[model samples]
Target: MIRSHSKLATALMGGLAAGLLLTACGGSAEPSSTTAASSAASTAAEVATSAAAEPITLRFIWWGNDTRNALTQQVIDLYKTTHPNITIETETADFATYWQKLSTQVAGGDAPDIIQMDEKYLAEYASQGALLDLESIGLDTSDWAEGTVDAGRFDGTLYAATFGVNAPVFLANTSVFEKAGVEIPDDTTWTWESFAEMAKQIQAAGGGEYYGVENLIGVDGASKIWLRQQGAQQFTSDGIGFTAADIQPWFEYWKQLMDEGGTAPATATIENQTTAVDQAFLGTNRVAIGFQWSNQVNAVQNASGQDILILRPPTQTGNAADGHLWYKSSMYLSAGAKTKYPEAVKEFIEFLINDPDCGAILGTERGVPTNLKVREAVAPQLDAANTKVIEFMDSIADELGTGGSVPLPGGGQSETIQRRATDAVLLGDLDPATAAEQFVTELKAEMGLS
Candidate 1:
């Protein structure tokens, strides 16, 4: 199974801490007006002297929506109540803009003290000596969710802490399925061929204007799962793990789906990805099935104004374990290598990961907290969509896949290569076999391989 931890530990990873102190007057009774005034002044002076340290200002940065932003600000405010000597400044942006701005900041040596990281750039920044070693700096991971402690490490060195946890999910729009009069297949026994056939059925109902799904050809993460199911990997620590033959069938699988009218036309297939998420086929409710991260069900619902059902991805052997789905970090938290206040950063990471109050305030806005205790603490407050997401995760607890997925140095370019080659094949400019070969060759070049 993908989850190395026991089912109880895997689904729940039980987990979250903070103490604020208030000064109390030492006197037994109220004193005279003059005496009171003198004592008050003395107490203030004493407090100031005791807390004496250069006032620390930490710049914390992340990418998220209004909900996440509000909850994050609340958490920051709560932390400051007990920390008069520390001040935290915050910066937030959408996903694309956040990466671009962060890249520029890092390049110029002005990166924020605490940075929210994505898997795509974790390697890029950590490899360049931009991220701090969380363990060496003394950030505790004992209470974190199972299988998550090492998620942010590279080369056996810790570099990041998980922010939230999610996994790859096959999403089906129930509203669309109802409209087409097609029954949602049983996810437990579904195979890739049957999944494609279901998509084709939906397309027949749409009469060519709408497709049943997006082409799997250009989805890098799902593509990784496909390779993993076959006991190969899309990436390795040093280089690509699969040869052209291993992935050639994958390209052909998508070609057959597209040929059978299961997906959008090749041009629309590629163009839809570059558009805003809500404007895409899945979000717009043009498709019945597609792939999405587990936590993204809410966004898809908001865009489509329809209910979405999260399904285990179809597998080659009609077994959930064969799907090779694993729990993945939604994002990560890392301190800048040059952070002036390492101790303060450690305290902040501790509170964020271990405090129950923080969990209650933040809810599932950042995805489910990796600490199982936090998930339970925040469960009552999550809305219907988020509740569904939680339940779905629990149902598939025992089927999680493990290992075989380790992003290499240049693996960020995997998406670029996949898109280009997929476009060529989907547009009929190249056959599936030719596109697969080119995909491998181009990826090799990008990663500096021979």
Candidate 2:
């Protein structure tokens, strides 16, 4: 998915040693009238102090860059101030290595108390009995938008709580278009054909300085949209939902873009595959348009130093109704099923999801807040880039189609497989049809459907 608080010093414990010693030594002696009241009060105060709960330590882990890590630490510090009894230890890693580390941790029976989850792997972990059911732990989801609460649900149980909602978006660098003397296409009326044509024109106008668009054949997000627009899904409750025939056209479209010089060359696109967001073709100003999650607009804009515009991905029919766009959880907050501090983890999650302070600090780093109240509270404070993202999502709120299906077990492997197949086709190692067929076969086998 899109993928800091101050540290409070430990509070000094009240002195109870003297009070206990006095109680033990003063056995049969009654205090004088003048000292009786003071003595009793002191004794009671010490008893209360001794009875106070000790601090509970919680471990939270997530995948993100230094920016996200710093912001999250601030939130943790803020939470600690109010919840002095809870201490949270955080671990962070980049997206590429996160799952590998987490899997190792889980295998060693030492998963973090709080886990930052993605839709792709939520089911994988949940089904394996690694995640706690939020509902069972008393999480409040009443304020979340419709279907958002359910995004982290599997088999009718809530395993994770959505951190925020996002949708696939066309992040257009408007400055690039203007420089190329090309007009931005109207998203509402644009089709796949028009999209390609616009890309070709932009490339032509740029005099080879920039490609028209980033190559998206390897992106699972783009593939999902393509499948959804065909009235199918990448996965269903049963198995692979779309046939090889359905995916061939998607591959064919990218081939056409490459042939027309509308997208980066195979090698450039492959190189872009492993590039960071800040170093990608779009971020580095090598393309006029690129596809990304809605929440990533700010980062791309900051990286490119351009007037980034958020547009709906083009539909097959050039109509909003035909577009397969829908709101999805950018990520989720899940508690470990085996956590020793479930209540503490639950409270932390609740704060992260519903607290305005958390929302303000987090902003759209994850995505727009899933909590309606938090979303509204942070609206006025958003930067220009985030404001555009909010506006874009609002403009298409009613037009979104049904949300995507829950990815099945082993579904996390689909993206890598798709990327490999896309690379093969773009490199002429496989035709679109052959790549599509191989993709389906590999995906079905990975998901244990065959």
lDDT of each: 0.81, 0.84
Estimate, for each residue in 345-443, the C-alpha lDDT of model 2 and write its tens digit.
888999999999999999888988999999999999987777888888888887888745778888889989988899999999999999999998999
Off by over 4 Å in 1: 1-54
Worst 10-residue lDDT window for candidate 2 reads 1-10
Q: 345 in model 1: Cα distance from truth in Å?
A: 1.1
Off by over 4 Å in 2: 1-51
Q: Whose lDDT is greatest here?
A: 2
lDDT of prediction 1:
0.81
Q: TM-score of predicted model 2? A: 0.87
Indicate the residue-level lDDT of 139 in model 2.
Answer: 96
Per-residue lDDT over 203-305 for candidate 1, one digit per residue giving the tens place of the 0 to 100 score? 9998865688878788887888888888887777777889888888888898888887899877888898775556688898888988888877877888899
- Candidate 1 TM-score, C-alpha based: 0.85
Judged by TM-score, which candidate is best?
2
